[model samples]
Target chain A: MELVGISKLNADYEAAMAVRKGIKLFIDESAKENFKKAGIEVAGTKVEMISDSQIVIDATPDGIGAKNKALYVSMKKPAIFQGGEDADVAEASFSALCNYDEAKGKNYVRVVSCNTTGMLRVICTLKNSFKVRKIRAVLIRRAADPREVKKGPINSILLNPVELPSHHAVDIKTVLKDLDILTMAYVVPTTLMHVHALTVQVDGNPSKEEIINALESSRRILGISKDSKIASTAEIVETFRDMGRIRYDVPEVVFFEDSIHSSNGEIFLTYAVHQESIVVPENIDAVRAMSGLKEKEESISLTDSTLGLLRGRLV
Target chain B: MELVGISKLNADYEAAMAVRKGIKLFIDESAKENFKKAGIEVAGTKVEMISDSQIVIDATPDGIGAKNKALYVSMKKPAIFQGGEDADVAEASFSALCNYDEAKGKNYVRVVSCNTTGMLRVICTLKNSFKVRKIRAVLIRRAADPREVKKGPINSILLNPVELPSHHAVDIKTVLKDLDILTMAYVVPTTLMHVHALTVQVDGNPSKEEIINALESSRRILGISKDSKIASTAEIVETFRDMGRIRYDVPEVVFFEDSIHSSNGEIFLTYAVHQESIVVPENIDAVRAMSGLKEKEESISLTDSTLGLLRGRLV
Candidate 1:
């Protein structure tokens, strides 16, 4: 499959593609000078590129994804909407670990948000090995991405919804219908990563080693011990940079191995989710599932391998 | 009682007392020019100030308080140490609501940290009305005070202690011995306030109204609803500024009434603790208790009233 990029904002489009490769790119002329300076040529706008693409990833800002749905539908192309879109805009609210089956061969699949994706991976990993009963999570959210200077909470903490069972839990339920979960979130003045304090209550007692082993076995979960000198989100990003990850993107959940505590059928742990990239692998897997190109495990493996999520320090 | 300020650093000493009045002062010449510009005169260093003082509030930086303990003892003066010092530095880790009796007439009393002071108010308030069996708190801590430019976690979240039962729970246990509590903390890039997601499990089921009324009756707990337009820490700080609070200090715990959730004998709620100011009233009450000036109820009332925490929008 060939990859194509389209955007009205040339600068944003150029910045995005500069980190990776895209064939047949289309963007406005706003960034033409910068592209010239960098010895890169730009292809002007092309609305007709949709006709050649099998699946479209509608990652436009929040509400715009819903508006773009009509264009994709008219072209008879499958599209994967982002978490920002309304759940009804797609066939399923997707998490590769939770509902790959539901998104398989579907016209549209909405990959859940960063926090939800991170929680689902842990819950699903445990559910596969135990009778998971209930879950409670406190999401310490980053105020904005490092590049979004216009965003804030610059010196404060915000209760985004100012209520219990923040929308994250509701969004997760859309993908894992029968799972019991509750979430609380506080938006802090940090642009790096989100930290989740999760408690999973199961039916019977599970040893800490068993739970740790299960989480370790998951390709998308990166466990780092306290002694590893990678304690905070800052260190995690630096580690990714040291490993030569483009844009210092950490696609896997950074689970603190020392934080794992289990007793009386309850498991408690803390993990950091790189909001910018945790959903990338899920988005790639969604495309594969929706296009009927591969089965669940195979699609996940392929996506993980392509993203280098299954190799090096991430493993 | 006369108040005297003493600091080796004149700038910090001047900054602290400029907001209030002190009969005698001591500091270096670092802030002499600024003090002159403000029409304020700074007295030279006075190491002998402790001789005439009955009770000294040793607000020195963390370990410094423990070291200063020697001087206080040498002068035979009663002193109040801050949370930074270990619990052993004082007669009791003092929380006015938790163990005022233990600190009364003591030579030294250590008021707990801002987060601990905030949590103890809520937990103690609930424990007064219910049999608080266990408590689990997730402390979303501010990275530093707004003035501490050198402190950071500027773009990342640091899991302080990177372990369970962060020192906060251990500190609380020092005062309320035999109380079952567990706390987790993450330091985020915010200098305004610390937000806590607290879960209190009691013996018998209590109605939401009962819990709300119990919290509302506490002088140190200020309840704000979601519709009150004081949802986040930024709004809370802005409101305090509009209220004409000195340095925008909020000495009370700003409890989000809308975040209160009660079910199956468990009470869940979220609150914001202004890190710079939440410990102020606690320090005042510690002074009264340490100097044997007033009983718990009377001292708390005096401190709350003097700090204006009992008036205006706070009520």
Candidate 2:
């Protein structure tokens, strides 16, 4: 909830106020109340300077390697790094996953790779389990702005850009390398949430009910049930005018009414996940799990219904 | 090259001028062409006339047994019986396929259902040969025509009177079943061709090349190939002078392209094949294939150097 950094957004005062809510002011002297200068430490790092920030999520653009490495090394504690298109990163730079247990005692940790984090949280739950068999995903994405390159029905992305999707599959491949996984990703024209079309071939002829129940057990997946619900802003997304950056709940198993065939005995289950929120659930929980404040369960329940709660393995 | 039929469609009216160079015609006032009224002399327990020109394709459209049995009796020599919705057609109705070899002296042969036909063709192709573990096909189609109550893409059909693209998958499916064929069918906007999206899981890792090749070989499959040739001309169709109703050379294939991913992967081969042409290729071959035949081939060969004959398939 505490927003920080990128003190100067090179934006107008009105634009800055419109984008922020709390109006916190811990940014560099040049930064206004809304934005902050990312003070990344280490002399040669991409960030201008590093401060004693508790949680440093390096949201850097693609294609930066050595600079980010220096930032991570400069950290007193492990830090979370996000390199959007550069998800195919080196593992040695970040892997607090195993140490989260010990680090939690110290109240700290670092993360790397958004794709790896998001896919891992969702896919890990599917791995170490037999209920999952195959995976197919398609992302309905929009450019950040419309003046951008043309994307399939995108909301807005300004530059003429080559929208991408499959690149994440490779990043995910490396993240889940220890576990057997396979993924197929596609990009659509949308802004934030990446909607995914998923298919899971269970070990046997498991009834639809069983599949639903398995999905309900994963903390990363949301299966429809009495207690389940799409995160609220969605309940109010229509209310906010100019709320162009809003997103739907991730792992929301939407029924593609267009692709269902009861006569043929087959169906393709689909979902959408916000890139920003993808790590929120796991990041909060990782601190707890590493600190021994939580018990190791077989799976985490993220949905309301029990129908196929496992975020099905990448394959 | 000869152009002989009940109608000398491609020739000039030289007959009236007493010329010998024109094609021949076999004219008769009463003859059966539509499958149902075709003359079938074979008599069996299933022999019974259900309607004047229309034979009950199934035992019953709404209720009981193999109504198509009536087709076995009404056909002139051999005719096709069909089942729409959930009608149960007798396997015996597909006898035409099984006994085609014996047709040296026999009269009729029956066959399987349309969905079954599409299913078999896809599963038996080069991609699977028993190497595939499962296959799922989603067939989104339109109603055949308006004379019947169409149950699909409901709102669109109600407002506009357009061509439909349903039932195209039946033939494709019938030709490739047994590979865990699960199909989903839809009734879309036009009365043209059926659209389908298929995913097949084989023994090995899925490959794009193999999938493309498998689809290319499916005679009923359209809209695929390295050339993005739009292998069929369904899209370019319009009201033309000579042809009464325009269609694709491979309607099933063309329809399939509409069902699968578009924009990405791109359509390499696509085009329309006149429906009448499917039934009259031989006659057209005599006229056009051999067009300006002998002399043209000689001149083309001399100028083409070699391998020019291969261009026929391209044209």
Candidate 3:
């Protein structure tokens, strides 16, 4: 994601030529030329034809761009729209997997930030449940912006990411119909995980255990587990290193919190995402959805295919 | 807490003169000013002169602030250093039967943030049974400097809060010395709950359920319950208001991170606390030390009355 995020597609000859040979995610013409020289299977029409399987991730600077139209037309079989930054994910939006049904033809669904997806899964799980009186999500992001990384000051850092909380709140509502709900997002410069310290004050006084159990029982696609708490920063780093040694086939994306401290006693615990492997989620999830796996079947799919295939190739 | 945070006893005013009128809690003073002209007493040395059954809160700032050193001996009982910001909780920290015990005999101890207390409890519980490996805490702060209240960049807003992973972790170890571990902490500028999305990769791969139960079974200081994966921002606000309606006692110190996103397929949970209400555990293990009230009737020495009082208070 940051590969394309750092800069726009360069149209120059070198960048185009280096496209194919250098890497595969997003290759420009110059880079493509480089790939052609390297003799990689530079398939597809060179005329920049956005064909089927040609997903146009709506990272076009616009928070919400006109990529849905592109998907409606180009998705001859099963196309996708990776809604990166500010793209809205409404209940009616294909991105809302709970409402997602069998597509008559090719379909276009958006995958917003890792933070939004995480928030959505949690909210939607309890949306219809009358237990909750209200819900709020703070999309705490990483310090390094893939598209463009620029350091900002702190006070402004805590500022809500959404220009208008109402619409975005609805965006959360479309998926999570809890009438009494709101969404607040902030971008912090820590890249271990996108910490979303949500506060849920239910209509009735429910036991904390009951609420936590409800969350733990949620789907794996949401990738949440009771095991992940606001981990200590040292533990977070240790977990990151542990993943490599344990060599888990699954791209075990460990979750931890920005759960840190202050002498002032202000509690700020946001989630963390390993900036290096952030895209690991998108790939695994995309493959799972593309492979036609059900909500819970994704794990099996990964075991039988996704992780297996990757491991096999590595060996 | 902000009152103590901002201003200090001016040197211009005679030291005894400042005491003659009586010590007043920040909020008490504010109330006297706002509601009526009856200026109230803050940290008055009522140990020897108590006409009313008033609450004598140990809202003193940090450790050093609590100790009555010879340098400040002229003052009856050294003024308990407290960030007057806690004037918000002045009513509760002192008023209610909140069983909080602080070392009052010329020593220092911390009344931590709720998250700080919760994290300390969580880690200590884990360390008691499991072979500890590492600990880390990433804290997102409100405003590093209380002065800057406006929206600002994430960088400037972040602070490495002191007394986290350390004061709590070490304090726990001081009593429960079963394992060796390392810790780290970072602070960001988001307020409310110090949402901690933690992950404990034990010495071996413990079943997820085992880990959850181990956590839930921990000490009673912090409530460790399960939660849903997604909680919109609205839920958070409503929860706050709801907590207000319930009139949660102890100033309802913590915020719940009902939605700490794990991943496309992960798990996360979190909790928060009002740092001050937390009792610094007796060196670490207060239960074993507080056995005086136990049915066994263990004859425990009452060397540290603060610890004894706390031990006596432990339920």
Per-prediction TM-score, please? Answer: 0.91, 0.48, 0.44
- Candidate 2 iRMSD in angstroms: 13.5
Best by DockQ: 1
lDDT of each: 0.81, 0.34, 0.37
Candidate 2 accuracy as lDDT? 0.34
Q: Model 1: clashing residue pairs?
A: none
Per-residue alpha-carbon lDDT of model 3 for B224-303, expressed as tens digits?
22342222222333453564633222222232222232222222334343332333332222232222222111211231
lDDT tens digits by residue: candidate 1, A153-256: 78788887776779998998998888778888888888889999998889989887787788888879888866786778889888888889989988898888
User: What order do you get sorting by lDDT, best first?
Assistant: 1, 3, 2
| Best candidate, lDDT | 1
Off by over 4 Å in 1: A4-22, A27-47, A311-315, B4-22, B27-47, B311-315
Interface RMSD of 3: 9.6
Better of 1 and 3 by DockQ: 1
Q: How does model 3 fare in lDDT?
A: 0.37
Model 3: per-residue lDDT, tens digit, A173-192?
54445455555455554434
Off by over 4 Å in 2: A6-20, A25-52, A64-78, A83-123, A126-150, A153-169, A188-210, A225-276, A283-315, B1-121, B127-133, B137-179, B183-315
